[model samples]
Target: MAVTVISLVVAFLYGGPQALFLCVILGILEVSLSFDNAVINATVLRRMSEFWQRIFLTVGILIAVFGMRLVFPLAIVWIASGLGPIAALDLALNPPPDGAAYFPNGDPSYETLITDAHPQIAAFGGMFLLMLFLHFILEDREIKWLEWLERPLAKAGKLEQLEVVVATALLLITATVIAPDDKVSTVMIAGALGMITYIAVNGLGEMFHVPEEGEEPEGGPSGLAKATGKAGFFLFLYLEVLDASFSFDGVIGAFAITSDPIIIALGLGFIGAMFVRSITIFLVRKGTLSDYVYLEHGAHWAIGALALILLYSIGTHVPEVITGLVGVALIGAALGSSIYRNRKIAAREGEDAVKTSIP
Candidate 1:
């Protein structure tokens, strides 16, 4: 509550009452877009130790707010303009010159700089998310959704690192066919980096993971043991990467709503990130995935849709509303399916109990 009040005050002080209102709207927009992210985060977070969870709330939030929301944009500007960090910061704070090509009204704004870099950002984020979705679907699991498609992928998973191959192929195809001539190299490079990041983080997590007794070597342990220091360290890295990937769209999308870096950081960083962490913890405590049975499936499908949209966006302008709604629709359908299944089971159990009583 205190943090929220302070952030709002800062927003108001920075840009008056209108900025404060925009900040609140941006925060809500971020949360709405990232509901699927919360579900996906919970899926991995439940496996982490309590200490790590605390770190996610504290250290993770700082990185999300300051590092990605603030520093990252500055770094991008620096790289793009060959300017120093201080210069980039100045550019972001000061409005773009009048009649600039980037803004709708030819107003000079930081939004122009960030929007110009969208292709690379989209390529990187798209590939990373694609790999994540593919990894989940291609792996063998007890629960299945869309088995007709998933079954083949699961069978193909028998091959070592098949997901990497598929991701590479898709990236190549996207760069060759869809990317503009000037942006081709940028797309390829960003996409490769995204894929490499996912592989490195995932490998590190698996390297330190220790299987519990009687666990199948392939199945691995369900969760990391609190005593294993290395396990916690690598899991922390994985979680951070996951959070960053989830933030990619939100960070980019936030620019559409506001050009002010301070407002963007305070709104999306503080409110949206805090809510996501809270949702993760709530899901973990309630065992929501296990109870629903299909929620995880829904989240992954939503991820797949997001991945495709990111890739498609490289060639065309896809509205943020469409991107967000696709996820909500998939997750909503999954929840409905889960409720129906639960009721059916309850009805069968009740019938069996009544028969036994009659006897």
Candidate 2:
């Protein structure tokens, strides 16, 4: 409700049907690019409780709008500038010559320009996304390179941290191997930021005094409701995070078409994200993932493709539309397959019912 009202106000304030149309087009684009995110998010959201869902819808917006929309672009600018946060602040306040070029057309040419102006940060974000995709692929498979270390760690009951340490080390190594020529320091900084964010969100959640609803006395139904709520909140946060990451390309790509920041943020931020959120919720309620087997699998595959697009953007150019359309096609195929499976099941059930009656 608040988001809607705020969007309305912004729309009116930024008046002109052009803004509204941009909003509509960008909204469609954003939803299309991140549709897979919605499906995967459902996997986590299913575990959350109703109360948490509301918090997610509310607080989650803050994280998306402020954190992703505002901070992320600034972060890129800071890293690219190779300046401290203070220096970055100065640059933001007092524009440098042609800083306007950064937001060209609606795409942040920071990546292309960063290749010239701030290559390091661009490389870092690309490498980071690549590592994440690779790590995801590895986790899905069962390769035990750590069996020897795992044995000793498990004996001491401290294997989980060891696994994390190993993963972190691996990512760092990958980043180092592919360190960008122009922005090595920037890449390192970006990598640190990403790591810090993960630790703060996940680790703090564990260390904090946020009490899990205490064990119900006398075996009363546990406040599984609260737990579910927390889960839902986390799921919502996950969706926001996923949305932000997915939109980075679109936001940057929009610049390829136009140089208007107002249009970029206004068009993409409000319109694109809303439709995506609605479609995600509709699918969740409909249990599309479960009913349409392999949808999650397809979405994940799309994520992998997007990650590649980001990485490729590091070396050469790839159109945002290409990346988005690829994702849509993959997910669409999954949905189509699911429909076929559902129909087949229905037909089988009907046949069985008829056979039983005949007998």
Candidate 3:
């Protein structure tokens, strides 16, 4: 809260009251869109020791804010435009006077360049998130928010490497059928890397986190599979990748609000990302996941939706508002179910207590 207030004050100084207002809106939107992220973060974070958790909140935020929001975008522009690092930074700092119209012989603005690169960006982030959602769908969990849907999916998971086969097919269709003729290879390559990254990080963590001869495995009922040393490093990398995937949407979406990269870095990275980390820690400390039960299921569902949305955005424009709303709706439904279940259980327990008293 203090950080939020301070940020707003700083924003006010930066561009007066209007900038302050924009910051607030960006913060709220980011938090809403990232509700699923907090849930997913808690799932991974609880497995880490307190030391790593601190690293996540501190060092992780720096990478998320300055690295992804600022430098990542710049890097994208740099590579896409084939410009030197300093030239790319200069281009970002001085976007074209008007985004909608291009001069006959002028270069595309920073916003235009980033917007043009959406297909590749979407390809990479979408596939990574799709793999995440697929893993959750394939896992055999005791709890299910939508059993009618999840049970059949779980049964289908018996097939060997089914997720990989399905993901590859989807990538091929998107690349060949959906992508522009010129961009087909770009989409395929980016999406393939996304898939490989997910597999390598997730597999390494599981492979290395095996318990030593004496000790019980650490992950709780959810089968988180955690460890220190190399395992922790992989887990940390996984978390960073997860953040990058989540931020892809926000980074692109912010252009809809403002094209100024500096303001975006401040709004999304400084205030918005910080709030997300705080929410993750709060969920971990409160044991919210253990209590809510279906919350994690909802988060994964939201992620699946987001992955599809990202893939769709490659061919068409999608409003950022829709993306944020979808996440909030799934999470809200799961929370409602959890509350109802808790009440029913409490009522039954009360009846049992009364019967015992009568005896």
Best by lDDT: 3
Cα-based lDDT for every prediction: 0.83, 0.56, 0.85
Off by over 4 Å in 2: 1-18, 75-180, 188-237
TM-score of every model? 0.91, 0.68, 0.92
True-structure lDDT of candidate 1 = 0.83
Candidate 2 or 1, higher TM-score: 1
Residue 201 Cα positional deviation in candidate 2, in Å, after optimal superposition: 5.5
How well is each residue in 264-354 modelled by candidate 1, as lDDT tens digits? Answer: 8999888777777788889988999888988999999999899888888888888888988999999999889888889999999999999
Error in Å for residue 167 of model 3: 1.1
For 110-203, candidate 2 gives per-residue lDDT tens digits of 4343234323333333444443343343342222223454344345433344434643664455356544556456556665665455444444
* Worst lDDT 10-window in candidate 2: 204-213
Mind giving the per-residue lDDT tens digits that candidate 3 earns over 63-174?
9988988898888888878988898888877766555534346777778888888899999999999999999898777788799989999999888788898889989988
Error of 2 at 158 (Å): 19
Q: Give the least accurate 10-residue stretch of model 1, judged by summed lDDT.
A: 219-228
Q: What's model 2's lDDT at 231?
A: 39
Kindly report which residue stretches of model 1 are placed more than 4 angstroms away from their true locations once superposed.
Answer: 97-99, 102-109, 210-228
Q: Of the candidates numbered 2 and 3, which has the greater TM-score value?
A: 3
